[model samples]
Target: MSHAPVFDAVIHAPGRLQICAILSSVDDAEFAMIRDAIKVSDSVLSKHLKQLEEAGYVKLTKQAENGRQRTWIALTPAGRKTFAAHVAELQRLAALTAPEPMGQGFAG
Candidate 1:
């Protein structure tokens, strides 16, 4: 199903957008993996995640692996839906500004 286009400032930020993009395709992603994918420092990723969490768009879980604690991240259902809508809106707006087809705008 197609989602209605809607602009979401929270999800639109560069780091957050990248996080959402990564999370959108997976059931859950490891914290380090996401940080690596986005090429951000741990603190930066943490900050971005905090904002997303506050917005109710992401969920964080901790699990024990071996002797270390690993954190996993996933997008909430609301996040998935909202992200889809935001992407649709971006596409819609992009299409509006896209150049006309070759020769379509020619006056000659």
Candidate 2:
């Protein structure tokens, strides 16, 4: 059986949603991973990531390893919940726009 989602926002922005979706499926990922997945320039991704981070939907951490600093990102508990809810909302919206069953199309 299929279940609907319960997200609130539409999250239609390409890079932003992709970021959230990719991050949702991982425990944590590096900046490059996210940047590559979204296929955006470093500055572009950084701007979008900053927005998510400021919204409390993502967490960023910096650590030094072998004299180099690495940045990692992970969804917060709240971020996970918010992203899940937003995806659900999108599902419900899509359901509304889908064609009706045969012989019952175009409901007013």
Candidate 3:
């Protein structure tokens, strides 16, 4: 069986998208690391994280690390699958929109 790729709007925003990209590459990442990598303010990142969390696309955990509270973020199984499908859909769209050879498609 085959199905069309799924595009997740929740993960489509630039910041959220970048967050998913980073999380997809690892089992987990520190919230600070993600914030720095995405170069967004705490409130902005927090807002995006809240949205993603509401969509059940990400999991957040807070714990003590070296006498400091650290927050870690990771994609849920659903998140990973949705993100993969979203990427595939984007690739498909790019392929469909790619320019063809000049003057090669018209018939006289």
Candidate 4:
């Protein structure tokens, strides 16, 4: 029997989903970069990042850069797997509901 699609509630939120997408494309991203990309305030991004971090789907590191502290974020191996599965499920659903091509089922 086919298995059900994997939909992780933790990563399902719009902001969190965007975060995962961004992290999946690169080795790591600065906290500010993700915030800007998601167009959220610092506190809002921090809240979402915290959730992902707690769920073991993201890793955050803080270091000094040019004498200033900066935070970098990246998805863990498990995060990548989970995100991929979630996306695959979404694609599958879309395909299942997609409309058929025109002029294929009717003949003049």
Candidate 5:
């Protein structure tokens, strides 16, 4: 949403980053699907999710399907905005460290 770049410590964690990246592209994702995509244990994923939830970055929904309660996760509007900003900030920072073009530094 063209938000100002921000460094979000909560989303900066690798696991959480992956989670956000995955969720950012989808309308909603299942808990097990995310867990498998990120290759983390249930508890590990839950921990990361709780952190995002605490920050109001994600919304979790529980539904009954075939007598099983399925949990679906999605990023809140704020989360999407912040994630975009955080990614932008990271891009900006990475650009700062980019190497100079070949021969640009050489005074021929």
Candidate 6:
């Protein structure tokens, strides 16, 4: 039987998916850190983050440290679980799509 592709929507977008992956690996990170990790412009990251936050996938907290303002980002428990499942599904898709050795399938 054939299997449908996983991560069809939210986790499929390149930028957002990258953001989710980065957040999944860390406990909590600052805006600058997440922006740098994703290598996206400030405005771009902000827009994407806002969407994630609204969807209840991420939490953002603004605080002051040593008189400096900082915005910290973290994945909620639900977000973590979703991201983990998305990643696993993507992995399975990759493995299934990979080219097999000779005699694996009919030639064109």
**lDDT at 82, model 2:** 79
Model 1 C-alpha RMSD to native: 4.2
TM per prediction: 0.89, 0.79, 0.86, 0.86, 0.90, 0.79
lDDT of 6 by residue, 1-108 (tens): 133334636656787788888888888889999899889999998998887888788999999999999999999987777777777787887887858778888768
Specify the highest-lDDT model's number.
Answer: 5
What CA RMSD would candidate 4 show? 5.2
Pairs that clash in candidate 4: none
lDDT of 2 at 22: 93
Query: How many Å off is the CA of 67 in candidate 5?
Result: 1.3
- The digit string of per-residue lDDT tens for model 5 on 1-108 reads 558899999999999999999999999999999999999999999999999999999999999999999999999999999999999999999999969898789676
Worst 10 residues of 1 by lDDT: 98-107
lDDT of 2 by residue, 41-67 (tens): 889988888888888888999999899
| Model 5: CA > 4 A from native | 100-108
41: Cα error in model 3, Å: 0.6
> Which of 3 and 6 is the better model by lDDT?
3
TM-score between model 1 and native:
0.89
Q: State each candidate's clash count.
A: 0, 5, 0, 0, 0, 0
CA shift at 94, candidate 3, in angstroms?
Answer: 0.4
Q: lDDT of each prediction vs. the true structure?
A: 0.96, 0.81, 0.92, 0.92, 0.97, 0.81
Better of 3 and 5 by TM-score: 5
Ten contiguous residues with the weakest lDDT in model 3? 1-10
Candidate 5 lDDT score at position 72:
100
Model 4 regions more than 4 Å off: 1-5, 100-108
Clashing pairs in 2: 5-88, 6-88, 7-85, 7-86, 7-89
Q: Write the residue-wise lDDT of candidate 1 on 1-108 in tens digits.
A: 477899999999999999999999999999999999999999999999999999999999999999999999999999999999999998889998969888788687
Model 4 lDDT per residue over 1-108, tens place:
134468889999999999999999999999999999999999999999999999999999999989999999999998988888888888778888958788777665
Instruction: Please give, for residues 2-94, the per-residue lDDT of candidate 3 as tens digits.
Output: 446887889999999999999999999999999999999989999999999999999999999899999999999988888888998888888
